[model samples]
Each structure stands twice: as C-alpha cells, then as structure tokens.
Target chain A: MSTQSVAHDQPHASGGKYVQIAVILFVLTALEVALFEVSHEAGPTGFGALLASHFVVILLALSALKFWFVAMFYMHLKFDLKVLRYVFASSLLIAVVVISALFVLFTYNRTLWWATGVWK
Target chain B: MTAAVLDHDSADAHEEHPTSLRIDSRKLAIWTFIGSECLFFAALITTFVIYRNSHATGPGPKDVFEVPLVTAGTAVLLFSSFFVVMALNGAQEGNRKKLLLWLSLTVLCGCFFVGMQVYEFTGFMHKGMGYSTNLFATSFFTLTGFHGTHVAIGTLWLGTLLKDAYKGRIPPNKALNLEIAALYWHFVDVVWIIIFPVVYLMSLFAK
Candidate 1:
C-alpha cells in the first residue's frame, strides 16, 4: 500500500543488481530442472541415492533460496521497515504451522481407518 | 511579509501529517494485506499437497505437465519483475520514456504468461484431465487456476498504470502507485517460484 512513500524516501538497488539477481534466479531454476532430470537416472547409491531419496528436500531448499532472493530484492523487504518484515514473517510462520498440522492429522486418520478391524 | 510567511508555514504543515512512528500509512496497509495473502495462498498450497497423489484413475502430473514449456513461462515472469522495477526507477528519475518502455514490456510478459497457462490448460483438457477428473486433477487445477487469475488481475493493474505513465500523470512523487503494483506483481512471481518446483518438478518423480 505504501510502497509509494518508501520508493521516494529510500534508495533502491541499482539496475545492475536487479539484472544480476535475475541471472542468478535463472540459473537456479535451470539447475532445478536439470536436477529433476538427473535424479531420474541416478541409480541407488552414493550421490544418486541421496538425491533420489531427498528429492523433495533439495527442491524445497532451492525454492526457498529463490524465494528469499526475490522477496529481499524485488519486494524490497531487505530495505523496508522492521514492522513490515514482522508482519510478513508472522503470517508465513502461521501458514507453516497450519500446513504441518494438516499433514499430521491426515496421517493419523489414515492409520486409524486402516486399523479399524470391523470391516475385514 | 508576516502574512506570507505564515501562509508558507501553513502549507508546509499541511504536507506533513503527524504520525507517531512516521511510517507511511499506505505502506503499512499494503504490507498487512500481503501478509494475509500469504496465509490464503498457504492454505491452497496445503490442499494441493495433501491430495497431490490421489488421482485414482485420472492422469497425474507426470502425464500432463511439460517442464520445458513451464520453464519458459517461469523465465518470462521473472524477467517481468525486473522490468517493472526498472520502470519504477524510471518513474522516480522522471524519465517518462524509460518508464513507458519498461512498463509496456512488463505488461507484455504478464500477458505471455497467462497465454501460456491458457494453452497448457486446454492441452490438459484435450488429454482428458478436466477439473473433475479426480483429486489430483482437481487440486492441481484449483491451485494453478487461482495463480493464473492473480496474474491476469496484475496484468490489468499494470496496464492501467502504464496508461497513466503514457498520459504523463505519474510524476516522481506519485511513483508509489506504480511501486505498489510492482510489489504485487513480484509477489505473484514469487508464488510461482515456489509452485513450479513443488507442483511440477516434485510431482514428476516417483514419490
């Protein structure tokens, strides 16, 4: 809402930084795609197994890094007020909590349903 | 002379509204709105993740998603964020030509992304994977369709801002208007940055 006031009051990143960040993002994305393809062929040991087993973890990590770059630079969160940072961070924390709770509840429910011996 | 000085001081006082923290009210409001949006998108994404593999008889992500095409679309969206920022810089620097050029390019990228989604959706339907196909199809469409809607809305928002730039209404002091829209646009792109890998790439492998 007030990006207007801040844009005038604070100095923003130069054009070169924006382009550099963009390039870094492009490389990260390409790496993500490449890893996806490579993991499909990585047998079942050493680095391949690690990548195959932890595919989601690796993807999420890379994704988080990309998210940080965009949020910090493009969204100007790095230079904004502490209040704004707290607002966004708190919401994201709540979201993570909710998502984790859902996953746990669903897992527990599935086990209970499968264990209910009346049907068999 | 006293009267003229008093009038000048009154004008200066009118420009500076008293605030406890000196924070821009609009900036706080927008940040709050964006925070709420984070939760909204989180819930949707959680739903998609929950039902990601529950396709039953319908096609799954691996069968329908094309990584190469999505990568292209993602690139376009990322570049547009850069474009909008440059446009905002132009606006702040009072370079109308630079502002218009970058803003127009940003809008074009937005349109291109939406067009890619439209094409991808139609292709899915052609492959017999409609929204009601199963849980997987349903959640996938719901998540992505909502994202596409956001992009479409952003495109319209930027289009209006670009029109203003062309008409010479967006001066340096008023650059905040464009800045707010750019924030929203960048936020949209950020959401896709998460979605692309989670929904598309992660789903491709055997889980």
Candidate 2:
C-alpha cells in the first residue's frame, strides 16, 4: 500500500502526480495493445494463451489501482468519517453479492432471471 | 478541495475536508454510485468476452483493429484522469482560476478521446464490420459505443461545471459538489482505463 497522505494543511498537488500516472497508463496501454496483436496467432508453446492470462491479471490489478486512487484522493474518502467508510463498504458488499448471484443464475439458465424478466 | 470553505473558519477547519456532508456524504454517495456502475459496466464487458471468441465473419479483432490508434485513444482517456486530479488540486486550495483551467483541460481531453472513438467506429464500419455484422460486431459496438456515450455526457457536464466556475459559483470556498463531480468523472475515465485494454487492446490477439 502507498503511504496515506494528509488532505489538509499542505498545498495540494497541481497535477505533479499526473506525469507519473500518465507514464503508467501509457505503459499499460502499450502492453494491452501488444498482447491483443499476438493473441490471435497459434504459437508453438501456447505463448499467446499464457500471455493472455497474465494480461488479464495485470489489467485487473491496474484497474483496481485506478479505482483506489480516485476513491481515496479525488473522492476525498481518505479524509472523511470512518462511519461513512463502513456504509460504503457494506453497500458494496451487498451489491456484489446481488450482482454476482444474478450473473451466475442468468448464465446458468436459472428460472430466476426468467421470472425477473417476466416482471420487467 | 471543497475543504477550502472550511479553511477560513478556523473552527470549521477541524471539521473535515469536504463539507459536502456534515461527515462524508459525498464520498459515500459517489462510491455507492460506482458500486452500481460496476454491474452496469460488467454486463457490457461480460457480453464482449462471451462473444469476442466466436466471431464467425472471418473478420475479427485483428482484421479490423488499428492497434496504434486504439492504444493512443486509451492513452488520451487515461491521461484525462490526471487532469481531473488537477481540478481536484485547484479546488483544494480554492483557486478558482486554476480550478476552471484544469477542469477545462480535462474536458478537452475527454472530447479528444471521444473524437478518436468516433473515428475508430467509422474506420471499422468502412472495413465491412459494423453494428449489423457479426458476433464481434454486436459486442464491439455495444461496449465501445456505451463508453463513447459516457465520455460525451461527462464532457457536457464538465462544460457546465466550467461555466459555473466562470460565474464564481464554484467559489474556492465550497468545492464538494465539484469534487464529487470530478470523482464521478475520474471513475468514468478509470472504467475506460480497464475497458481499453480489455475490449480493444486484448482483441488484438483475437485473430
């Protein structure tokens, strides 16, 4: 985890952090583009397949990092109330459960989606 | 940056960073919206993944993609996230001029990305791949198309915000609402941060 910086007292960043973030974003984009180009071909050692798996993991991690930064800094979550954190966390957990259940049920051809669709 | 209002009032300075809520109402609301949006985006991503592998038109991810173009577009959108942070920076100090300037830059970045998207969509259409084409067609059009729509909306909203800033309504003192708006804008950019590689870049391998 990166250090938790204060959101007060000090002068705010004038996008001094931007160049670093842009560098990372560009690197990741290049890697994604490269991986996409290579995946369509059949390699001797299934390199494309192996690389695709790794690519997905890396992309997800990067995306999660983006989420954390925006939530912490841009959203000002870091300097806010602890109770508010709990509220958001609990809501997120419930939403994940509900969405996951729905996805699984629908993908599995469960009757729930049908019934739900009927109501819709 | 909404914390600026609390800056002058010494007693309020101890209150919190964003006075949008007595506590952290803005952060909480924004996160909850993000939580819901995850599913909204997930549906599109899932559809893309499911169909991406099965495009039968002989035209596929490799056939239509200009990797460099999509990659550059991704770069533009991701970099815009930084500009949003810049806006946050200005808001933090209650610097109205800086805030508006940075916000304007962010919206410009957004519009540029949207322009690239339109160009790419048309480029694909010219290749005999379009909304009416194949499995890849449906998935590609749906995912990227929704993302483009979002960028457009975000640009419009940010423009409205800049106008607000011009009228001095976004006074450095009360920056929470703008911060929340910036937060939402960042989330939109972050979503593209994921989608670019997942939907566009990864497809380069899709032969």
Candidate 3:
C-alpha cells in the first residue's frame, strides 16, 4: 500500500469517543442485570409475566448492542478497511448459523446418542 | 519486489510489502484469527447450552452462579477494553507515557479478571462441581476455562507490548503491535459480553 493509503487507513486517537462508548456499555450492562432481577420477580399472570416471557429476547438485544459498540469502536472495525469487515462479518455469520442450528437440533431431538444420559 | 523500508517512526514501517488487500498483513491476520475464534467459542457455547440443565447429578446453575460477582468482573473487563483503546490512541499519537500508563492498567485489569475466574472456579469445585461431576460442570468449565485462557494470553501479549514501550520500541510508527493486541483484547471482551448475558443471566431462568 502507498504511504498515503496506509495513513488514510490508520485510525486517529479518540479517547473521548472510547470513553463515551464505555459509559454506554456500562449502562447497558446495568440494564441487563436490572432486567434480569425484575423478571425474576414477575408474577405468574400479569404484564409482569408477559415481560418475563420475553426476557431472553430483551437480554439478547441488549447484549448485541454492547457487542456492536465494542466491535465498532474498540476493535476499530468501523474505521478499518472494508475487506477486514467482510472477513470478520462473514465468519460471524457462519458462527451464528451454526449455533442456531445446534440449538434447534438439540431442542427438537432429545434422544440423540450424545444427548442421552449425564455420564455417557 | 518492493523493498521493505524501516521508518522507525511511522506506523507503516513494518508493512514489508504492499498487501493485496491494501492493509497491514498482521492486522488482517489477527482479524482472521478472531473470526475463526468466533466459531470455536460458538461450538463450546452450544455444548454448554445443550447440557446446562444436566446438573441433576450435582449442583445446578442457580445453586452455583453468583450474578453479582460476574457483573463486577464484566464491568472491569469492559473498562479494560476502554483502557486498551486509549493506550492504542496514546501510542498512535506518539505519547509514550500515556501508552504505558493505560497499558499497565489494562494488564492489571486482565490479571484481576483471571484471578477472579480462579476464585470462582475454586468456589465451584468446593460446591462439588468438578470437571466430570456432571454435564453442567464439564461444559461450564470447558467454555469459561477457554475464555479465561484467552484473557491470560491477551494479558501476556499486552504486558510484552508494555515492556516494549518502556524500552522505546513501540514508537508511533510501530503502534501496529499494540493495536493488534488491542484488537484481540477487545474481541475477548465482546465474547464475554455475549457470555455474560447468554450463559450466566439466561441460565438462571433456564427450564
């Protein structure tokens, strides 16, 4: 790469932005914990129960937000080259797919050999 | 062939040759390694999820997991992620003192995290959760243990870079070394970001 392109690809130092991201992440984590606590106390039949039912979805959404912030800002993927983005994102996509499939398969088929018995 | 010139002051000094992707090869390689790590952790996580409730032979998640402690560790790790980036920022700006200071704090955070994990594992063992005690124990140990190992490795990498900075080797031109380490550190942090909620919090309510 030419000097100019290399310099252009280099991200500038922005401590302020990083600190802001960190604060946001902290708040999100607190929210996650708070949500868990609240859901833990939800009643069996009410709006609270409704909220309790969707707890996993909400928690995952919050976690995804935190993941995005760290990946974009701390990892500098937002400012890095597009090729790097493609490589990381593609692999992440495959990983997500594999995880989803495994969950679905295990959830539906509990009689598989590996799924049988605690000691086998 | 383009000769690799050592600038000793510019960040691109170690480019060696023009990469086909127009990026530093080391940076690209680290990202690729991180990408594959995603799948590796994914498989481990899947195993845990499948067997999370198989603790019928021993203590279960609710009986063992302490969310409060893990939340504190999560915060420390998140803060360390911020610290490492600031260190990178300092390094890229040619501010040696700032780099060393933040890097040192980051390493300390890493050590604290690992120590906390060791303590948590010991507590789990005390509760009769050995590696082969049950399915839950096995999967839980394997997953979190690997993550803790990564944190330890990242800590050593950053510690080495900190030493290099002390020797005036990681100048502005060679900040790529620190930057690569920072990327790995941040990747580990993000993986825990997922694990904190998915494994720890969600498991509390698992059926």
In model 3, which runs have C-alpha deviations exceeding 4 angstroms? A1-5, A45-47, A111-120, B1-17
1 versus 2: better TM-score goes to: 1
Residue ranges of candidate 2 with Cα displaced over 4 Å: A1-19, A34-53, A82-120, B1-21, B24-27
User: Residue-wise lDDT of candidate 2 within B1-207, one digit each (tens)?
Assistant: 222222223233434343444433444555566666767787777778767866777578878878678777777777777777777678767788788888888889888988998898888888888796898888889888887887887787777777877887765545655666676677677678767767766666433
- Which digits, one per residue and each the tens of the lDDT, describe model 1 over residues B25-96? 555566676787888788888888888899878798888999989999999998999899999889989999
User: What digit string (tens of lDDT, one per residue) describes model 1 on residues A14-101?
Assistant: 8888889989999999989888988877887878777888888888998999999988888888877677779888988888897779
TM-score of each: 0.89, 0.74, 0.90
DockQ of each: 0.48, 0.24, 0.50
lDDT of 2: 0.66
lDDT per residue as tens, model 3, A1-120: 233345435555488998899999999999999889888888898876886899999999999999999998898888888878899999999999988987998787766656668666
Higher-lDDT candidate of 1 and 3: 3
Candidate 1 scores an iRMS of 3.9
> Which residues of candidate 1, in runs, are more than 4 Å off?
A1-8, A113-120, B1-15
iRMSD for every model:
3.9, 7.7, 3.1
Candidate 3 Cα deviation (angstroms), residue A26: 0.2
True contacts kept of 1: 0.68
**Pick by DockQ: 1 or 3, better one:** 3
Docking class of 1: acceptable
